[model samples]
Target chain A: MTAQALALPRAPRVDVRSVAFWVMIAASAYGLWTLKQNSVPTMLAFPPSAALNVAVLLSCLAVGVWLARRVMRPVQAPPWNGTWLALMWGGLAACGIAILMNTRLLSVWSQSLGLEAASDWSAALTAPLNEEVAKLAGVVLLAAVSTRLVRSAADGLAYGALVGFGFQITENFTYGLNGIVMAGGVEPFTATFQTLWIRIVLTGIGSHWAMSAVAGAGIGYLVSASGRSAARRVWVAIGCLLLAMGMHFLFDSPFLGGLAGTLAKPLINFVVVMAVYFVVRRAFRARWTAVSAEEAAAGTLTEDEERSLSRRRSRRLHLRAFPAGPEREAQARVQRLQLALVEERVPALAPAEAVQPWRDAVAEARAAR
Target chain B: MDDFKGNAVHGARRVWVPLVVAGVLLALTAVEGLLAKALPASEPVPAGTVIEFGSTGQVSAQVGEGWTLDRTASDLHSGLLLTRGDVSVRLTSVEFSAGKPDNAQEMWDGMERLLGVARHSGTEVWLGEPTEFDTKWITGGLYGSLQVDTAIGTAFVLPADDDAEAVEAQVLGPFDADQADWTAATEIIDSVAFDEDDDTGETA
Candidate 1:
């Protein structure tokens, strides 16, 4: 069967200019307002240094977004647009809410009960529950806003990681700013720089992003699964959150260090990073399988095409088999057609007609070759 | 369908969209930076004063003379560490989560385990069983003493109050003889106070 024989059906494009999107935007604005109010005193405390630190951090965040997008492109991942949205609307909002909920409210609640605001035990006591819930809320918000975009577990995971990264960067900046003031007007830059290096560079991935991605997978399941029982979905969601909290607790607690000595922290971080990687990798593999199966069933994808879809090495090897120029171009068209075909077949992705021109181009390229 | 091909111009615009959005975010960040710069500096929290921790003024304490607030020892609700003259006294209050054992004995046992006394043999000197004692804020509470070989030396761990599931506060003293001004450390511990009206307390 030739590529021309394959039909390209159309689905209605899901627009992001809806009332719900604006409403979510408004909610984020409100959260930001609250955050500013809560942060004013600290901001004023370390003004000049805080400004410089924030500027540097903002630049770093931009670079981070650019880097993350670059990493995603190789895997034919979703657009960077949604990742930015999750960061701004989801991540920033969650950060504001977390500050209010965890820092202000939870502390009051704990102390009202005559509890020792066990500052040392914060990672286990306060952070896991408040931070996870706040961060996960952003994923939930994105899912609610763009159901079509976040149609699968992988999408949920990617968006969730973006949200977590956003929260982490903003929180890190705030922590650095606070650290400046706490350093009691000492070497502000040195204090702020040390804080940034440790929080931003050292523990960046193993912190919020890893935790939220797992929880977002659970969110992915809840939204994507049509026939699952409500009870089952609730349990899955709870289990994912508990796992996220457990990871956060481990990272925050001194328990592991006590057990493994100095090796405890890095060991825990390694275990967490590996666990999250496997979980997300498995989800992506499952989605890829589903996409391949659909394309194969439709006769749009040959066995060779499906083999390339299975692994990055296979895809690269297939491309390298062709010489440069027209031969390589033709092979590249085949790869593009495969991707377009999957998008067409995958539920709630881009419409088939949108990719029709690419299919025709591939057909022409093959004929020319 | 009119060729179903997106125009080259439209594709180019799509590419520019991310850059435009990023530019706007960067501009907003710059504005925030400007605002931060404009703000007047906050008055520094004075040393040796009764600085309130969190919204719950419930956890309030004065750092000893020449001691500053050790934020590393502080959290969302709790304050820790009053350092002066080679001695540092750490005061921490932790609320137990629901469904956890609340008895004083179990709590002390947990603390012992946390300090690695039960796990690491011969590393710590456990003085004896906890006896009933009273701090300024807490009345009729179980208290015990231990000497950790590590940086965290002599410590007194005890319950904050007599509630069935009360918060636990520990006052860690110095183990080194040179830094062993137990009188000043005890005074710092005694100065620890908790307010009943948490909602009305300062949000610092």
Candidate 2:
């Protein structure tokens, strides 16, 4: 190991599960209290049917989970536990925090500042700042559970996206319900459906997930990124957090005034998404390079193996080059071996014994071929 | 040495990434500003003739020639009610004693039912639906439309020009009214304008 690698800080072995469990319980209690205090009366009147809200939430959950899995597939990240954590603590807990901020903190701060709740400044200034911070808390909570889970910028992004997915889906459901109430207490289904289409189908990608993922990359760099100098890590962290906030600000701002209702909305969404894509792609590639370099140093990876594993599509292509019968088995062996390599590398992950069988399977497949 | 090089490159990237992101955002904002400027300030009110309303004449409607102003039924703030043949365009703002309702259309519906406006002599025929209406100078994208008594006697209720506890309405006369009168009323509503520069100078 390089002196720099040995000098890198290790996170304390905290009991992440217990901490996460307590956080969830607190979030649930707070959520129930808020619901009783604010939502119950309106819900009784049935502006939008409860069933429709549940359907939207569940459907979004299913799609979000599926998307999280797909994104991790390319990276060969172990995602089930992290994905579950994101859905429960990130989704449900983060949502509770957001509601508390919106209902209580925002209102109190606005009043103190002598700003009316409906004022333009309140939305332009207070909303984006508070909401982004609240949502970022979800990523922080995820990291707290297990720093190893987010040991690189790429891992941070995937987990962050999942956290964002949870928050977005929950917030979308509320927005759908609110739209029903706004459209004059008639045809709840129509109003809610319209809201769902706009929040979910149209602006979903440009919304919470994209912004939070950028912030998560920053958190990832701070906690992980062993090679980076401390000052560089701080700069990256600050830059990413600010970028996330700025994206939210630009989206929420009425700078274009009435003209924004036209072609400007989609244009702005495209710009923000592209900016996030740039950061994400760079960070992801950097982490991959670091991992590959480590493998190279270990002398366990052949030149052919290294080339094949470099890209997801290329890796698949390399596996597929063998004949169909044993070729498929060999492909599976390669996948298992790669997964095992990742597990073996991470100290907090499964031990070397767990990966031995997968290595054996790869050797058997190579011999058969 | 490779690790050192990789770290140096990443460090450099970290410094430059924010600049790139900021530049992109600034460029997009500039484009938005330019596009907004290029678009016309507002579409001109359609009809050649205009009737000014409100104390400061902040609100105005472009009316067709044949319609006569109903001064007794009108005021500066409520707007000038116009009548031609049996058709009447009662330009009025419905103010709510309570703060703004969660849904303005539902509130209007309740008011109509309570006032028995649609149930004259117990013969009832009224239906409402979500619809779109545009005033030339001040366009509300979508609003509520209620057809009362006849196909032609419709009341379009929308969010007020600038008030939350109030709604703006343009009611047309029964279907029996002359075709020309109906056309004129619709035209006038479509061409309603608001001039924010002339704030009604009223102190609370």
Candidate 3:
């Protein structure tokens, strides 16, 4: 075979998976464009407040990148997978369900505890305990279905972070729309944007993701440990879940009277989250190194296979690193779908079927660019 | 292992960057506060300059070789007018007086007696309404009635002989306690012909 034939094709086959991926990208792009159009006038008038919002957004993006790097280590299965899609969509759905459940449960709990009539602190106390547990349930479900997917605490955290990000985006849109209606003009829109930036971006403190990752890591450990029973893993998961709930509770508590009080909680939460993140990162690095050494010793993966995998991964990363213009965005949409199919490990679908939707997405993305 | 350690260091650096930026912003705010103190204080309106008026009639006259009056109306039935250096004022629902008199209380009592009579019977008198009504008539802008008791009724009217003259007349009514008050009544008149001297003096 020629070198070109031997090499894996750069283009992805179009399919249902590609269609779904393209649709999501298109929806997200449209949503962002609409948001920008709505916000530009207000932001221009209130530059300082707008600057504050942008600062917060940039900070959140930085934190997100950091979380992705720290938690998405170890090449258990490639980063692109059907499970990722499911996790993103399922986690977002779970957050909605959780919020609903938490509201109902908290209402009852508060009434029972005579906290129904209380303001601020009482509500905060109830919310962190109830909502954090509910939001972490998706992470637990993921861990249960695919223990190998979460190789370390970092992996758990990464998965949780993605889920939390999805939830936050949805919640922000809700608040933004409500603000537009309530304020009925530019002033309200600016205020709403600031509020959204602070609540979602500043105080994120890895609440949903950190808590869920703790739970995910514990479950992963239980499943992977040769000596551990399934029952032990369940208990470990439960314990981690409870710990996360406590952290969330303390983070949300209103012990402080003013801005000082508000800053204190997020600061403390950040410290705790950082500590957990570092510990998990260390464990992931060690475990991956050990696994690589053993595999080399056993010769399960030859030097050639390892080199091939490395080259493949690098090519994928290179594709992502390309400048994000119209043509590049289209290519990315196609490539991501192909990767998703490969992750699914389904050989039945024709390559053309897999590649077609991606082509369409690329075309649309190109137009947008 | 070296690469791993380098990555970890990079991660630590990321955490400190935001903190440094925050510190810089705080320092800038402090500098702004210090600069604000160098600005000058604003001046207040000078004394004797009429910045505002109170709820009582006040007539300020600038009299040199000639006389000019700046009168302000206040309250119901209270107003001030001046002509030829003579200032007349009516107090709220009660008093009336003339001249740039210093004792307002004494002047008010004398005016009150005339007004009391005007109120009891149907007498021609100029009455001030709420602030929304026109004040030009009370400010010597137009002919109006200034009535005392039934025995002494003063009517402000244009003279039949001279269209330019604004004159007041005291008419005797049948309900007078004393008929002599009518003959003794003082009528203040102003004629537009007074402007001839002002015009001739300006030309000279």
Candidate 4:
């Protein structure tokens, strides 16, 4: 394994011609349609409660997507379209798949084990197996859609979180609708509001987003073009997925029954994600610094440029010394190209021509400076 | 740059990934659904017999003869669904984390929404107003009737055990169904009790 080989695909680029891209669209559309069939009528039936749930959930979705993008990656977040695509896959494709699979599987358990036993065990046994795979599949597809979308574990974590966030909000909205039934429908609006808050406040911390992010990191390992051994990558991927599923099972399981227990489940999941984030961030930073050092050795980047390139604010600070207008713009372009070159660089063993495009692009920018 | 075309290709296109993922997912769902369909999820429910269920065994209700309990659809935590040849009856109870509704009328309002008549599109149906009625063992229960083009039935909301706030039951069947069907439905509704210990509405 040449420790994770590859050039970063151009940022924010989707290989639209890829089979994966089309497959994602088709599956997501089908899922979205199925969900609408059940939800739309309920919305129309009780317009007020539905509207309230919609307003609240949509607000949460906006905040979640924004926050996930800002925090999931180390140096910078994954590009916008990829992040949106991951969320789309989560909300539409994964949720749809879970609905179909869980309904069937839960019935099987109920019939086979009888409702008495199935009640305690069915959800605990089912959702982790079904929903985690469904959500992780989205991350895998994004990688398949384009190498640029998820070049590292950091990329996978970010995209995975987005996907999970999408699934979480969609699930929350569904729960709000279901909440009416649970609360006996006496106070429809109140029931909806109560359900949304409990979910958003309590479980939302660790739920689908955290679990999928873990599983997605594993996919990052599996798909990484780096030097990690094939067996190692596969094992890490499997382990991460199982870990995610375990976390989910605990969340849905009957062991912890009350309010404190409810809070504990998500807290546990949040801690696990934070651990993975730190490790992935560290690895990404290490690789980044190593690449910059190599570029400096080759006289492609000056010491000051190398020091400031990886961080946005630092880059801005470095560029501040230059006068305004054309000079600043030229220097900014050179720095941008330099960072791109570092991101797209392959290992030393690869043929020299492999990095020629990015290197040439950087040189042109430098000349503009 | 040709081999490295499309924004600098790094990895071999794993085009087969999505196909395999989707195929496996569909395949699993199909297998599970088919297997569940092949096996029955119900047992015969006899008349004038007590049925004990729910998350714990505390919740109990009497059942009428000639119905099958759909264990798969029914849950110990929430309620039960039973079916006969053409008639289906469901006895559901929810213990609200918040207290019960303020009044039977509010509960009736809940039952109306629960019937979800408005959710079914392209249907012409009439739902009658609920009237307060006294049951054999329980008093002041509310009942309403609904007809969806052909099938007709009544829905009930009754005071439950102290632990549980209330219980709701609905019986739906064809119009020509015999009085025995109605007798069985009534038998179950009259004796619907949330807790076996309380036995507030125990019948002979």
Candidate 5:
């Protein structure tokens, strides 16, 4: 079995009885219906173009999600159900909340500052505060939905990226519809393509996903049982949120206009996220190594196996030593159990006594081999 | 489950954390709602009043006294919208900000594109010959008549000082509008002027 099998020590099943589950369901229903009502007439008027826009946006979303789920997480993806929940929160709940909040906030700015100042400065003022907080709320709610869903900064990063992707796709769809009206409804299909090209192809890389990923990592740090002090976690979480907001402000602000500036802003955000990712990954690897060493000293892992177990490639190479059949299968099973035990033991999450069951299972599997 | 005990919020009270966050969001939205309600929705402008609009108050127009400003829809940044009887006037400086559709014809075409966006469809739009659109305060602008559906009204793309900005105005009314009301609307248009001295703002 793959390390994915080892990633299931925490419950993956949804608890329908939980308050979070029902809340998510209600929010999604209200948000999706409200959004549909707003967009239905336009969609009906231009069915073919609307369908094309949805198809293209959905395809982009699928690709983004596949990348995050398959390649982004450290050891394994978050549970499949949890991944869906993150998307739902971003697309439905967050966007739906933002429509109302942004409208009110914009009207306030327009009325107070006058439309003159509001037109130029309102978006830069409103979206960073309203949109970012709204999306981040979903990340927090997802954690509440499953306490085990986010145990490390890496977990937060994955969930956050998925959520952002969802928001981005839905936003693209809305923009695609508006593009028709903007182009005067004369060339509806052409207008839809133009909007998609700008929203999806041009600015998609460093948009909602990048911002939410940064904030979600903060949530992970806050909720994680990693040995950081409470104050540090709180500070880091706040720092990430502010940083995300700043990035959003830059994107919406009037400072950087034109094609080159458009390209540069997203690039700036992409680089920042990559840097944050490397830092989080480095910390996670350090914890992983410490647990591997601890298990090795207890003689649960042979010295050779301990060295090879941490890397998927090395594990595959080590498995070659066993003959094909039950022996190789048993060895693979032992490797998976060892990983689960090591993951659970890392940091302050599990004490030695609590980890004994995983260790005993690995031992029995090893003895069978 | 036992291992997760110490890890809840990294130690108890973890489940309540998200709930608290939800409470904060609810509170923020509530405050926003209250703030919006406190804003004045509509305002009345006195007759024969010269209204200075846009960022620097560069564009000035005198009202003939019947139109009530749609305060909720009006913005100092983009001019304003007002109405009197069956006639509605919308003034917007989108051209100055976007830097496109430079002529009266382009502005008229832009209106055609804007109709669907404004939820008006299957309408006929025809424009008249170009003429001078100037007032005592503003000069060097294009003026024309725009026919929408069966209604006809005057359209002006009045230029701002330094010729860097222009405000597009449309006064729409029925094809067979009242003669006295139409004359008053014309006087209102004739009063469109620009303040050449104010340079504090760039666009609406």
Candidate 6:
């Protein structure tokens, strides 16, 4: 076997088009799990307002996904090397360390100055800036060690998102435990749950990941644009870092009304994001098509893949081809698995292979179409 | 092409971690829901009965097992006139008056003595004639009323008489024509008698 084959022995052969679909599902699932394990207990405390809390959480998640899609370009070819994992874990650790250090320092300073000790804004301001910078540092480290990990803006976003997810889970756990204490038993659990819903889920607003990804995107952009001067790259990184801080400030600032006001701001942000998305879509409309063509020409897409893509054009054909039959179901599942592989680019396929029956069913449906 | 190869590799690792994490979170949420459902209901506090203190000299009322004697500004002004559950009461309009006094000193001494005795007994007392004078005797006119109505009667210790004869009889002697025509008043006094000897001494 060739060295490339040896290096990527278990790597599945598929077009990059399928990869994005899988990565999104995996990321979404992880996000959902983290949200449930860390936030549900706190939400239960708000028994009376549990439904409202759940709604808020769902809305926030939707906003996060929408923002991710709009601001970050989709990575057609994902680099699944351990570099992404290291960046994710390292980013989380760095954020934790940064928070500890910044909080201690701020506490001492605020005390000496006769200011209120760090509670909401102080932590918000300090954490978003310091922790985001730290997480961005992981992206930088990954980019330095391996040029492949952050070949696109979307790659940076994915890594940053993972890091943010890690940070969010740890933070939510603390918030949940605090809620339990405040509730003082089951009677006030509803109130506790509501508090957690507002603080952890709704107010999250993707501040950490968005800010870190902004920095990561800058680094990726710098690395990709060849022959760029080091000074120019530094300037670009600094600009991105500043922009991230500004966004963090807007997110954390109390300028917005209290809980209701804060909640409203995210919606406003979403609207603004959507508008920007349309603009971006207009600009990149041709670019995506060109990229798709290039990918297809490079032998990345098989004849079956082309047929499957065509089948999705009509809803009737789409449904009929991707029918509920075990064979079609298996093909669909394989398609999903292959798509995930293409998106995440992770080499381990045992988990992916486990879902082959579903993939095969999906693929057969495509062939029928 | 090399970049594409790199991206393909990176994309694969991203899928599984999030999926596993999401599954765990869903399970946690379900557990939380179950725990919440299992929690017992909270105990409620019962509402207590209302206890009214009409005049408020010294209110010695039974609350549960204890007798509470509350010394507040007599319900005449802004004192505790009632106790209902967790709430207290205060009468807004009320006034008191003495029919006769030998002299100003006697009147002042009597008012002070009555107030002191009431205070000692844990009952609040106020001194002032039920007249059309908008002045407070205690706080140098900071607070008082001249109105003598049913609401005022409820606050004062004096008896109420609606009969013309009875009210006229009550405002005799010391309250006669020499001092003032009590009959000119719209509301007649129940009784306003002064001792002859006391009046004589005052005149002398």
User: Highest DockQ, which number?
Assistant: 4
DockQ of each: 0.04, 0.03, 0.01, 0.46, 0.24, 0.02
Full ranking by TM-score: 4, 5, 2, 1, 3, 6
What TM-score do all the candidates reach, one by one?
Answer: 0.57, 0.58, 0.42, 0.91, 0.77, 0.42
- lDDT per residue as tens, model 3, A1-369: 222222232332112322334433343344355445445544553445456555655565456645554444433332545245424532344444444444444434333332112223444555555455444544444433332233334555666555555555444544443343222222333545756766675665545555555655554444343234668756866776676677677666656646676667666766665666677667655544444343334443334332323234653565555676655655455344334322222111122243334334433433443
Q: Estimate, for each residue in B54-139, the C-alpha lDDT of model 5 and write its tens digit.
A: 65566676776676777657766557887777777877654332233345455445444455333423446676776875676666
Better of 1 and 5 by DockQ: 5
Candidate 3, residue A268: CA error in Å?
Answer: 2.2
lDDT score of residue A107 within candidate 1: 39
lDDT string for model 6 (B19-112, tens) is 4433443453354345434432111112221222222221111122111212222221122222222222232211122123222233233223
Cα lDDT listed for each candidate: 0.57, 0.55, 0.39, 0.78, 0.74, 0.39
Q: What local lDDT does model 5 show for residue A258?
A: 83
Residue A152 displacement in candidate 2 (angstroms) = 1.2
Q: What is each model's TM-score for chain A?
A: 0.77, 0.78, 0.59, 0.93, 0.91, 0.56
Task: List each model's interface RMSD.
Answer: 16.2, 16.3, 29.5, 4.0, 4.8, 24.8
Candidate with top TM-score is 4
Better of 4 and 6 by TM-score: 4
Error of 6 at A292 (Å): 3.7
Number of the candidate with higher lDDT, 3 or 5 = 5
For lDDT, candidate 2 versus 5, the one ahead is: 5
Model 4 global lDDT (CA atoms, 0 to 1):
0.78
| Model with the higher TM-score, candidate 1 or 3 | 1
lDDT ranking from best candidate downward:
4, 5, 1, 2, 3, 6
Second chain TM-score for model 1: 0.57
Pitting candidate 2 against candidate 3, the one with the higher lDDT is 2
- Looking at candidate 6, what is the lDDT of residue A285? 34
Expressed as tens digits, the lDDT of each residue in B1-204 for candidate 4 is: 434322112455456777887788889888988988988878886555576665555557776669788888788778888887777788777655444676777777776776573546546556689898877666778888977667899888886534245777778889888878777777778776555553333231
Checking candidate 1 for backbone clashes, the offending pairs are A116-B93, A116-B94, A117-B78, A117-B93
Point out the worst 10-residue segment of candidate 4 chain A by lDDT. A1-10
